[model samples]
Target chain A: MRIKELFINNFRNYKSLHIKPKENLNIFIGDNAQGKTNILEAICFLLQGRSFRTSHEKEIINFDSEQSKLKTELKAYNQNYSIDISLSRTKPKIIKINNSTTSKPELATNFGTIVFTPDQLSIIKGSPKERRRFLDLELASFYPQYKYYFVNYQKVLLQRNNLLKELKEKKQADTFDLLELWDNQLISYGAKILMARMEILKKLIPMAQQIHNQITSDKEKLTIRYRSSLNLNSNFREELIYDQFREVILKNRQQDYLKGQTTVGPHRDDLVFLINNKNITDFGSQGQQRTIILTLKFAIINLWSCELNDVPVLLLDDVFFELDSKRQKYIFDLLNKDVQVFITSTGMANTEKNLINIKKNAIFNVRSGLVCEEEL
Target chain B: MRIKELFINNFRNYKSLHIKPKENLNIFIGDNAQGKTNILEAICFLLQGRSFRTSHEKEIINFDSEQSKLKTELKAYNQNYSIDISLSRTKPKIIKINNSTTSKPELATNFGTIVFTPDQLSIIKGSPKERRRFLDLELASFYPQYKYYFVNYQKVLLQRNNLLKELKEKKQADTFDLLELWDNQLISYGAKILMARMEILKKLIPMAQQIHNQITSDKEKLTIRYRSSLNLNSNFREELIYDQFREVILKNRQQDYLKGQTTVGPHRDDLVFLINNKNITDFGSQGQQRTIILTLKFAIINLWSCELNDVPVLLLDDVFFELDSKRQKYIFDLLNKDVQVFITSTGMANTEKNLINIKKNAIFNVRSGLVCEEEL
Candidate 1:
């Protein structure tokens, strides 16, 4: 979807701001710490109901103000939509669509946005937790059922852990019955999650490979494999899962008692990245690793487009300046076709000229916290 | 930031997909599990060099393939920018900007984006670890310096914890000199982080209150108090911190040995949210708690905008459908202005008329890993 207009009041450095986006290309140029990124962030906030920057909603308010409001008008699928959010200092923030208040799930159903930020490189260099989060989020957004199952799985996981702790503390035998009940719930949800994740991976692998070939010029072949303690080769019925873990759980009872924690199940599952039949984490160069990540992202985009039937809005914040000319040109040539884009740069000079040549383009100069349109 | 064009190959569902976004608004609409959110996630992956949906890059590839690629051409800040990512089933994900390979930091500098999702609500409802993570991610994105400091702090924390573990195992005297050195590093980096957080919080409090007031119709006030065990009330100098923790560390030395972990410092700090002078976690309705989170998100958007001088992209995945109509309308009205927006919904019937009225909108239909543009 594309954003038609945005209004910010007491948000960041904009005491009161209003802007209309160009249909094809909108650019924000400013010096460091200017309000360039803020404009983009406001859009993201309006779409997602949270900031890409900080977790605390209070931070968005202007320094002297006790609240902030973000408003946006969007045109998608031959439709018009509005979103409003108000931030306060003494109570909870309120969100409304059109003019009605809503909950997160409902809000999610109404607005869907994707963002590209620099920190995403962590998917490669960071820990497994980060990677898992990526999968969970993507799945949650596309499949509401995933969200429900995921949330339920987590709840069960937490409750199970707590029960394990209690069982240990009380040194009780009867608690096994309670544990069984929780385990059944966990398996029901966990198995569903596991199946869904596996299915998604199955669907994503081939597409990722072709993109990897293009990015690497066929220099390398990459592979992704899901590794779970529970064998996927066998029947994954609830009874099977319980049977597999029963002995292990009983044997680890003493350890669980001592540690006050649960030690097995999907929580411990990991995804393995292999390059040329070897683990990339253990052997790949930094450059190679980065390329692998890039390919994966591209593959995701392709998959998303194919699955969703729409090209998502691209938000590029200061990323262009970091790439070499050849790669930059490839990207430019590709995006030159038909996509609405918003980009933030330290300065306009840092960008490529092809972008300026686009017919439908709007450029804005951002300083401190104010934005003004610039003539091409 | 707005997306101009997107191309994906073998990432998740699309073996090969290409689409151009509308200049102003684009919508990915489909039934659950159709990959609408995946499109947004792919964009986020390109910008961040990571996926917002999954943690593992390998998982992004189609299941039958070995790798994936995501390419996006962005008209940002009046410039053309391209980002390409490659993910392999057997290797690390790779990234390129404008076709030239680059590092994570370089990618981050070039592409900046902000995203908001339904999961963010957990920042308020979840444990303190989640909240701390929210803070860290924001700080790391806007201020690269904080990233270094955070890394260093983590290193020191790890080392100190290891030393504690070793001492306990060997039952040796405390390594006072080594401890002192680690403490110095920890205090230095921790102090900087705490200081920056405090400064940001100082600005966020007022804004959150005001927004909360508006959301609650002046029925409640929201407050965020940073509750640190580090004696933030006093001068946070290294000397003072050392003095304050000296006795406690010394006395707890043996106990720490038994526990095998460091028991004190900023790592143990918590962020407490208060509503109407009462702790929300301790006493607040589910709705109140949700509003607190919503307000916090808005506040974060404002804070990031003000601090970084750029508005980050908003990623809203199914949050709109979760709220009441009043709140939904508020968000819809807000979105009516200027911010570039990307939204995903099961259908348009639930959205505001204004959003439905825009003509320069791209709408896609997603189903079972297949996408088709809707005839407008």
Candidate 2:
């Protein structure tokens, strides 16, 4: 999948901008705060129908603006498509694909992307929430319906947490009765997430390990372990996992009551990275951690491509500058010819000479919220 | 000040390692999980007598080892010093400076180092707790006494928060009277922290702004505002701020009762970034966010230098690879010649030539928990 063109108005710092990106590689370069990342954010918003930067959609609107608009033309699965989206402060965002209104998950199912930002390093270094999201995102690309259950699970978890907090304060003896209802709802949705995540990891491990070995020249081995709160010894089964979850929740009820929050569940799960049988968090150096995360990216891209006939567009946001030249070249060599990549960097003069055969790539300079394509 | 030598035994992945560092630039090069950061962690441990990676000291002990030891020989304030630290599984860490036992904070006042790591970006892009810690770390350096006050403040805050939870759960009227006592203790300590943070920001802002302008070549402006929960308009007087805090806490008592968490305090504070008067969190690009964080690092270095006659050694743990050449250059040029810099990277063959002026720098290779100095 590739975004051929993008149009934006009153989104973030941009007043208005139109960009035509090449099918192979497009690099946006500029000084700091000159709007290099805004282009990538625009592309991400187009593909995901949302901004990863913030949860508040209204925040995307330009200052003193009532709404924002984004339009993109892309080719995916050997078919061309157009998407129009309007983000408003007073109303819900309106999204239309091919001139017909469509759900975000539906749009993502047909046209999708894989993104890596410098910030995305958090998956290897951040909280459990980030790790869980990493797995869920990989699962969601293959099973778009998995996102539906995943989001619903998150919502139910929050609702359950809020109820627990309130019930604890109220000191209701029968709070368990109400919690049982929330628990049932939580498990119903959570079980799908657990199953999908388990299945996806089984598929991703060998691929990630292979890529990891190549990156390290086989000096170290990489392995990713899904740390489910249920602590199951065997592979997932919906009924069996559901019962295990309920039992665990019951055992933690007293502690949960004290904290006024759910103490156990998928929400508290994490991913563990190991190299040569040693856990990365306790033992890996910075290079090892970054390499492991990079393998995860390749694993995700491979998984997404296997699931869809079209290769997913790759978005690299301010991450190219962070990698060493060897790792940078590894990324380039790893990218499939059919994959379209958009990269943002503060400067890329040194890098530009080494990408896209050193000639056939789109380069744009962004300044003060405006973008201008440079002649090849 | 510069470190002359470092010796580590049974720390993290390392069984033992010894290093002699250059006074100008010492770069540790290795693949991931090869103990590059363990070297920095050992330096940080010898100086600060604690691990920045984890609070639990036993975790730093090499697996199956009973203890970990870190020793450093450094020069500070025109005097040579030797520091030794040992972490054991069942006892508190022991620290000795120049053959005499010393408290960590007291030793830090005489021999200190500033560190920047990829993980430190949390100061700009992480939780409120991280932001608060950023402020407190800076404050503690200038006024080691400030740490005493800050620790007391945290203790009182936790006590007060716990009291709020208990009060809400029990629903007793007399609990209000007990709450008053906790509130007074909370106010006393909170005011000091609030005042210290405000004063430090006043010192830090102009320096950060100047560096931000230089980094951007005057293409943008950067400003920081300390957004305290107290929301004060002027520099603090303990009594005046305490009164205000008491009133605010009283006003939020109902909401606090509902949530069972204290809603007003330094714990809830955050620092806001602005570029050209636009909130950076909402408007800054990825480059801009990183630049702002980089400015904060420079500003901190400056403040620490000004407070002490000795130039603080700098420990860069896998951060150089993430910075662009321009940024990497800016940081190197900004460092005083007297300052010693320790850098860790996975690959630096290309960077080392440019960074060492093609001569006169120390390079070390780390592999499988061992360190070896490379010939020039």
Q: Considering every candidate listed, which one attains the maximal TM-score? A: 2
lDDT of 2 by residue, A1-376 (tens): 8787899999887999888787677888776666677777778788888777778788789887999999999887778899999998898888899999988777767677777876777787778888887877777778868878987988998998898888887887465878888888898888777777777888899889988877677878787888877876475688878888888888887788779998888788899988889877765666666777778877777777786666777888766645555566666667635568888875654554456553446888887887898776
Please, what is the whole-model Cα lDDT of each candidate in the order they appear? 0.68, 0.77
Error of 1 at A192 (Å): 1.0
Across B135-222, the per-residue lDDT of candidate 2 in tens digits comes to 8887888776788888887888788778888887688535577778878887778877787777788889988999877776686778
lDDT of 1 at B151: 86
DockQ, 0 to 1 scale, candidate 2:
0.43
**Interface root-mean-square deviation, each candidate:** 19.9, 3.7
Q: Compared with the true structure, what per-residue lDDT tens digits does model 1 show for residues B1-376?
A: 5677889888676787888776545677664435666777787888888776556667668767888889888865556888888888777778898889898777876666666654465576568888888888866766678888888889988998898777765677655565677766766777777766766677778888877776666766777888776556534554555466554555666665678777766577778888767666644433455567666666766776576554445555644433434455555554444345566755544334345535566677776567777666
Alpha carbon deviation, residue A65, candidate 2 (Å): 5.9
Deviation from native of the Cα of residue A110 in model 2, angstroms = 2.6
lDDT of 1 at A189: 79
